[model samples]
Target: MESTPKHQQLLHLLLLTTLIYLSSAISIQSSFPQEALPTKSGYLTINSTSGSSIFYTFYEAQNPRTPIYDTPIVIWLQGGPGCSSMLGNFYELGPFRVSFSLRHNVEHLTLVRNSGSWNRIFGVLFIDNPIGTGFSIAGSPDEVPRNQHDVAKHLFIAVREFIGLEKSFENRPIYATGESYAGKYVPAFGYYTLKKNARLAKSRRLNLAGVGIGNGLTDPEIQVGTHALNAYYSGLINGKQKMELEKLQEEAIRLTRNGNWSEATSARLRVLGTLSNMTGLATLYDFRRLKPYEDDLVGKFLSSVEIKRALKAKESISFEVCSDLVGNALNDDVMKSVRYMVEFLVKNTKVLLYQGQCDLRDGVVSAEVWMKKMKWEGIGKFLEAERNVWSVNDELAGYVQKWENLTHVVVMNAGHLVPTDQAVNSQAMIEDWVLEKGLFATGQVTQKPSHIGTCSIG
Candidate 1:
């Protein structure tokens, strides 16, 4: 049959469009490598109502005594309210640590196997929590959480989805763990999990076994109050200077008491900034170091084309170590106390609170003050418990105190990031605490479920 010139032109245009589409697809496919990741990684929609999702990377235990499915899972949430959990993953306890090298004046990044990864005997799940941080995507600006309540809620949903996705994860003991700002998060999540579990059927409950916090800022009122004393005692300030800092601390406390939360957060920052100005030290995180701990390497590595492709991260969203947007949004919630949550968690679950000896912010003194203030039935017993010397391979690692379900440890020669400062020791601490070894062998820890069962999604 004879065809018109218009029909012939339409056919040619269709063919050209199909070829271009195929070419674009091929180009996109070629950009990413064909290799598989060593661990399971992906995003789970946590809030369908708000269109939010969370990104996670799961590493199975490398040397578990039992089957992989039966091994305990540690869900690590890095604090900053805005900081990415990837920092905890790469800089601290992930199976691989990011290392850098210079050649011909150009720096190269590489991942090296870490001997002290926390996943040695227990599965580790690193989550970039709360939307709009790390690779986690928020549907809109409104989707970003403004309070610990929303943060815990999002995390709860994400974990429920994760467990539902994998049949074997149902029965595994889960520990909510994190450091720094996550001090609030860990307890909030634990408390929320317990609250939710109370109403849910037995088969649908989250198997939350315990909670662990390291150098965390759980109670800002008590924690912030310790700054002046800690600084003065550490020789960063004199008596007169201490008095001045105390004035600033008092103002922060007043604002916190008045419920001017944002103002309190600002006041807290001012207190820290003033201390930094007076000390002229490298970083309050670790005063011994002459320079600040740099995380530019981590930002560089995670944002690279190759790493993003490997982790299934969206290329459109840039990776940041911390998000100021998130920080600003939660300013009002910062100075508020989560002490009640901690008190509740300590009663219901195994609570391990640890501190780095040298950390001025949210460190030993601050934790001690709050612990003394806790109205828990075991507080007296905890304070009276004998402080036992903890060692790793015959070397002094730290001092530990245990009473009932609570354990507190003062890690020697460590600072804000204990895992990063004392890798081997921190790893050993987690392994022992989770497995109920050494000082944690008091036999009062929560028992793991003996039978494995699938969780039904409500």
Candidate 2:
């Protein structure tokens, strides 16, 4: 207490040094993430409600635009409520393939070039969501959503977080694109984003531009009705088999009318089974494949020691192409219709509905039937619009029709996976619509310009 002037001077010096040190530390902390630019395969962890950790990867544009801010981002979701978006990555539109022979083994696998990557024009994001799907982990069973709304909310959080972390995405136009079950997820997420952006106008929640669903299972009641007709017209079912399919469809319709989603789903599956069980050579997802995806290929590649290390993935993580546990948990949600969400999207932005010509699972006709009936803006114009052939490099790629901002396309010679079957053509279609509309040349008029029904362009 009775210190000399010298002691006071030393104390003052020490106080000054500490403050300088603290300031320097704060500056360093602020600049900490200047670590080398993140790689294309970067992870995004979304802390979702009910305590779930959603995992996602952004494969920056395959051919990213310079000054990257000008480029666009498209989030790609896989169909299964539990399926890994990695399926879209390796098998459909991502830049890399698990292996040349994805049919079986990943024993000597490599990441080969995918000519059909959507990243050619936009930065692509793949998410493993719904708590326990793919490589995503849930803190508990409570984290998993029991309904479509909850799942979309989690993804909404994820998208906001992604924009915050990835500065490059802040100003770019974004799209929500998915196939199969994604018909529901894409629209739900799009509607959620639209509402969120409206509330937070000062915030740029993905600069959402549009949504595209490819051969998706969106409206089950309307879509399931097309199965019997799809079977008969595709020459899979005879007149008698067609009649039997009609019975299954009628049963499904009755169940749906009575609010029995589970049974309705079962009935729809039976309608699909009419063709599957009879053919002994059913390629519901594809006309070329006899069996389902080779799940082992993705499992082995993703779970491998070297690959995981490269992506900086967690240790002791298991990978599933589609998680039955997650699927089973959301079984009821999947069978319900998301037409309202689609209606909201239709009124707001460009809505692209693409169907693969060969898909028996949620084919083109199902989408066409419901879309015409939906009470969205311009439905009547869409109903009466004439079809035109869109040629890619002077070859027939698909048939396209436009009504206001809504676009409906039926890709020729493709199955459930349009990009996988018709990568170049698919790219041309997406690029034209999303970035430069009315860019591709028109070819010989599509078959029955009166109907724009179906014709091979390739």
Q: For residues 327-442, what per-residue lDDT tens digits would candidate 1 score against the true structure?
A: 88788889989999999998899999999887877889989999899979988877877777777787777888888889998888888989888899999999888888867886
Off by over 4 Å in 1: 1-38, 443-458
Q: What C-alpha lDDT values do all the predictions have? A: 0.86, 0.75
Model 2 spans with C-alpha error above 4 angstroms: 1-43, 48-51, 64-66, 101-106, 288-296, 439-458
Candidate 2 lDDT over 157-218, as tens digits, reads 87777778766678878888999888988998899888888878566555888999999988
* Backbone collision tally, model 1: 0
Please name the candidate that would achieve the greatest TM-score relative to the true structure: 1
Q: Which ten residues in a row have the lowest lDDT in candidate 2?
A: 27-36
- Residue 201, candidate 1: Cα error in Å is 1.1
TM-scores of all models?
A: 0.88, 0.84
Angstrom error of the Cα, residue 349, model 2: value is 0.8
What is the number of residue pairs that collide in model 2? Answer: 1
Model 2: colliding residue pairs: 396-457
